[model samples]
Target: MFHKEGHKIIIITFLLVVAVALGAEYLIPIPWLQVCIQIPALILLILILQFFRNPKRHTPHNDDHIIAPVDGKVVVIEEVYEKEYFKDKRIQVSIFMSPVNVHVTRYPLGGEVVYSKYHPGKYLVAWHPKSSEDNERTTVVVKNKVWGEVLYKQIAGAMARRIVNYAKPGAQATQGADSGFIKFGSRVDLLLPLNTKIKVNLHQQVKGGIDVIAEK
Candidate 1:
């Protein structure tokens, strides 16, 4: 199924492609040139439709486990100092999303949102060492009964220009539920307790709301 967030853009693109194809058929006398123009336009619409597809996922409900927030490859798993809400050392797990991967972001666990903020910055590569802090991103913190506080940030990559967030402080978040969406490619960074057990390794492919990335 297609994502609701892309309905408007997808419809507009579909209409534009139809208009262009009809215009070329009637206005252009050369049949060969009309086929060339219409072919590329059709391909463009197909690619856009594929990018916004939202497959049905069963979100595992476990307070001790942390689900992956986006479909991508595990890029980094390291301990770093978190300066935003925690201001302490924490384990960070980063997933890098390509243009072909789903751009939807989901909650890692069920909890109450403690912090939600947006930061506008440069559009660096998703895997850059400083991209988590330097790139346009949104920080969200959820506090659960099993895990005190878990922080996740959605960072925009060079190709991703828009980041949509639905998290708000004091709101309840459901595990594996849609939290936001990023246009194009991007990365997601999760900051957990320093001793949290990580289940995935670097370069491992993960699916949003389906793959368990870590545990308490």
Candidate 2:
């Protein structure tokens, strides 16, 4: 069976290698190379383990309404002016993905991709006020019959340098379907029409592709 959560194995392997390397250094300390080489190894191990430890909740069925696109704490939920594409009033829900959380991005609603674009920019902190505009990100607009046009952004944060988005214009995407994955820490911004009802609140912990973030 394919390990849906295979990151855990990578963490375990990292820890084991670090332990062995530390043991080897202590057992055979050389002249100037006597310094411990395990510090960096330990630090890397900690980071990798933390990333895999975050909750890996299952993505809900496609029939469900708007599910969350990333696992993280809901940081923003208010009417915001979306400038890049919509350039209009939208209810923006921002989820802050820590280094420990899953970096995958999922479709929030079922629809055909009407527009998709990638912006190359700086890697600001995910929550930085200008990160959404300044940071490297992918904007995807999906047109749905029930919800009209819904926009989702895959934003690359300081630690996350790569953002993988598979959505292409004219492609059909279903709610809760795996749309892409981000490496390391990041954030996801969902831009919905102001009239959409928010089902979650700021600071609420959410599971990507599982927890409903809003409804029509």
Candidate 3:
């Protein structure tokens, strides 16, 4: 099914496509030129439909496991100093989502949302080495019973303009449930405790809520 975050854009796109197609067919004298105009309009709508498509996922609940928060390629896995909240070393697992991938952001694990904050910054490419820190993004920390605090940051890429975050302090977060959405292409970085085991390798394709990223 489609995601709730895309409802407005989808409807507007549908209307625009209809108008453009009809306008081109009746107004343009050249058949080939009309076809070109309508085709791109149709393709734009199709891309929008696919970008926000959110499929149902049955995530096995486990306090020890951290599921992938978004469908993407595991682009990074390394121990880095988390300057914002942790202020110490943690294993950072970054997943890069393309415009073709599902843009819905899911909770990595069920827990109490202890910290959630937004930061405004430059729109760098999702895979940029400094994008995680310099991009427009939101940082959310979910405190699991056994896992302590699990931090996930949604970083907006050059194509992304808005990063919608539903996380708030004191709210309950369900594992694999919708946490937010990132418009267009983006990346998500999960900072786990030092002892957490990395389950996914770099460049591995992962389905959100279905693929595990790490474990206790």
What is the C-alpha local distance difference test score of each model?
0.95, 0.81, 0.96
**Cα error of candidate 1 at position 68, Å:** 0.5
* Structure candidate 1, residue pairs in collision: none
Q: Which candidate, 2 or 3, would have the higher lDDT against the true structure? A: 3
Residue 25, candidate 1: alpha-carbon lDDT: 98
Model 1 gets an lDDT of: 0.95
Off by over 4 Å in 3: none
lDDT of 3: 0.96
**Strongest candidate by lDDT:** 3
* Local lDDT at 115 for model 1: 95
TM-score of 1: 0.97
Give stretches of model 1 more than 4 Å off. Answer: none
Q: Which digits, one per residue and each the tens of the lDDT, describe model 1 over residues 1-216? A: 998888998999999999999999999999999999999999999989988999989886999999999999999999999998899999999999998899999999999999999999999999999999999999999999899999999999999999999999999999999999999889999999988999999999999999999997
Cα lDDT tens digits, model 2, 9-127, are 57576768767677767776673453456555666776665665534456655542788998899999888998878899999999999987877688888889999999999999999
- What would the TM-scores of all predictions be? 0.97, 0.81, 0.98
Lowest lDDT block of 10, candidate 1: 51-60
**Backbone clash pairs in model 3 (N, Cα, C under 3 Å; residues 3+ apart or in different chains), count:** 0
Best by TM-score: 3
